[model samples]
Target: MDRTTDIIIIKSIDQLPSVDEIKSISRERALKLVFKENINRQREEIGQYLDDTLSGFLVLIHKIDPELNIVKLITDKEIEDHQNFFEQCAKDYRQLGQKLVFMLVDKLDLNLNKDFPLDTFNELKRDERQIGKVAEWKYFVHGFHCGFQNIITGQYIEVPLVFGLEFGDLDPYFFVKFILSSPDYHPLPIPLFEEYADGLRIIEKMVSLGKFEKIHSKIGGHDGTVVTDREKVEIKSNLDLEKIFVNHIKEIEKKSKFNLWKFLGLKK
Candidate 1:
């Protein structure tokens, strides 16, 4: 059988059989699911709670080898008592000598009575701390992952609204375009590519001075794959761009004993 075929997809609670049922599932079967399908090391998991109810659950079981295990539970709005159900699952899995590595597949929707100034744009203004002193930066961007979903047309559709963050004010658009332009895939649309290039130029101009600002892009995807969408770009009072570039070259030299151009068979 194909290796992926041995992996199971659990869509509902009824499929669980019982805590005893999972225990009966061999270690080899369990290991295949966790390593092959579930834990996405790229993006941080986002949880969603509905009207005081948990809507879904995706857990990877790694307490075994030869196979990985995954348990996925999804429910409609009717399941109001999901917390208790999840607690029971935890208890059951504990008995089976397995722990749950939770994953969320949907965005959280919080119902607040008033519209407080909690937006990212607003928070940036209210927080008066200096950019470099903040220590941490949040970069948010959205993009698609092909084959993550299936549409009505029976084609594996792309997941387009994926969003994520990373440390520092990295421009995510540039990072994504760079990755896509690699030998693995084609480049983004011409217009979008130009927009990203222009944004980078503006950032370069700003970096000449001590002031560093965030560049927002609607088409960019986050998850550190795109580093350019950093919430805070370091603004050193005595910034030296040339020195930084030289330092980067030295760092690259440490990793690569020979020049990159020479490695690519290009004449220096």
Candidate 2:
């Protein structure tokens, strides 16, 4: 499943912990302090109120300025003492993410719910067999897979039957072109991509002076066959994902103008 939300509180230089604090303490501590200081208390309940996919989940503060700090929630005695503090940290960040999503929605000028980039399942119309097999996958993409469950049920249709192309034949070039297709043929609105890019620019400004690590996805790319082990790459936009997908979607608008004609059965 292509899912995951990376929530961040972009802190200014002065707003961030002092150099001494960052140097002296663990990342978890620094992040908690950042939350304690910066998060707006009024937005604390936004997570429950929204009650979407991103809610009830902890989006760890993956990175700060000078270094990468992917704070993990440990389940030991040491963590138990600070559990309340850490819970609030997660809540604050979740609310912060919820607020930013709404702000992005407002910027898009779309009447979308609080879940701006709603992660919808394989929601198809009409007949069930019309869709083929439905696969639901939940796995890690940040560093490595720690736990996972990927299941596919129902009549699975061969790729050639659906897209008139072999699954193995699908490559980056083709996928990129397809995703980058004209807005007229695209499933998602092109404006959403534009607004996402705009929001990233704003985040870039917010953490200009602080340690801003390029968003990196734990997931790697496939070159038709093998799933290669990968390093953390610069994935801007919240997830290495948003930045990457946003860039890909935006590029589709720029380079694939002929898609509209093709979709209309016109020679392109």
Candidate 3:
């Protein structure tokens, strides 16, 4: 009944909070936030998987280059076909760019007074007041864009993800959009099916932590009274995680002949 979700806006990489900061709402609200965060975390893993998959494919294609003597007699049509296929795959990634991973957890053991009222949860809708709060929360929570600059197959594909939540008093449902930039932006909705079931598993861990081991805190309410014994929502305040992508790019350079600057033709 009370506003339990903490509103913390993370502006810099240095300010990232630990997983322990999650202490806000209880029951469904807390669970929802956990689900969202799990999805956010998985986006990075999915991006890396895609990068590795694409890179491995490119290595095979590179073998056909004229610089390699093994393919001295390859046909032009064959080369074109490979190029076309790679381009098409990139296009497909662009289309799938906006997809969001949604997953439901089995919480028969939660023992909460009110369950989410669904056996398998795909989406949840709240009223305007709640939706506005959630939108503002997600806007600040999912505002940043971070991922490796994908240059495999001679294509520039960056997974710059953006998240948005919206609801209108007159509308029948709440809307969430996960936007990904494949050099071209695509906006997609969170679906009922799990894009990755691992997200659900992560939330299960969070839920167990939240239910039994939460670090309780106090906050001042509008009446200037301290609200005690409140569950704190995890505050993730740092943008430094984005540096993982930079590190990944460096690793890619170390392992392969992919000279980024040379690829850009700025350096020999």
Candidate 4:
């Protein structure tokens, strides 16, 4: 499945291997190790609140493009635009007599040219009679493999969004997206791809600065207990996740004034 959440590493900088040293290792092997270590660490430390996909694709992005400063990409104008979008979503949902939230999650951008087996699969294509057999063979080999491209923007842009309707259960595993082509929706006020990228930088800053605990604490006081279809699941939404998220952003704005570069010490 296309994951709708970014893998935010909550561990301290000292706990992770140096980027220079990490780059020396095979990318696949390095990612595997990061998954192993991060999963174990998160389970042992703060598994109660912060659930994350344990991978280092973001690290690879940094290594691949050394000057790819995601932090530098976030701007005040962008944040305002993002917050406005969130408010709009909230307003629309309320009019529909439902609650909605958008969450920024870690997304894996795979180079289909390299990572996907398109050529290999094409080579395995068969005649009509053997279609079932070939499909079975492909399934046996590739399983659920698919390309990682955004259907809307047609870009390699991969980002995850978390959505759990007000009355529904929220799991780390669930997400929902509304397509513009769908009859139920209107055109978005802002460009989604640009907004997502900016929001990612903000989330990146929050996670990197070791504010994971603080952020969760801020929202923890509110009740998270809710009954789902099967049983009760505690999703850390302070009644309304959209409101909590907006409040958190407001707090962040007050704290850093949205100048993440200065707050992160990337600026002099």
Best by lDDT: 4
- For candidate 2, the per-residue lDDT at 43 reads 28
Candidate 1 structure quality by residue, lDDT tens digits, 1-268: 1112244333432432344444344322321232223433311221111111221223332343423333222222212223233223222322211110000111222221111111222223334311111112112222222111112222111121222121223243432243233332222221122225433443343333323333332333222122222333322211343354467678877897677688799987
**Candidate lDDT values, in order:** 0.28, 0.29, 0.24, 0.29
Instruction: Give the better candidate number (3 or 4) by lDDT.
Output: 4
- Lowest lDDT sum, 10 consecutive residues, model 1, at 97-106
Predicted candidate 4 versus true structure: per-residue lDDT over 206-268, tens digit per residue: 334332111121132422111111222223443555565477679877887467687788975
Order by lDDT, highest first: 4, 2, 1, 3
Please list all clashing residue pairs in model 4, or write none if there are none: 4-160, 4-161, 5-105, 5-106, 5-160, 6-105, 6-106, 7-106
CA RMSD per model (angstroms): 24.3, 21.1, 31.1, 25.1
Per-model TM-score on C-alpha atoms: 0.15, 0.20, 0.16, 0.22
Off by over 4 Å in 4: 1-74, 93-188, 194-197, 200-268
Off by over 4 Å in 2: 1-75, 111-268
Local distance difference test, candidate 1: 0.28
| Better TM-score candidate (1, 2) | 2
lDDT of 3 by residue, 1-268 (tens): 2213333333332333332332222222211111133234443443344334431111111122211000011123332434333233333433332221110112112121111111111122222211111111221111122112233322222222221110000000110012122323322121111212322222233334332122211111101111112322232112432353467568877899767688798976
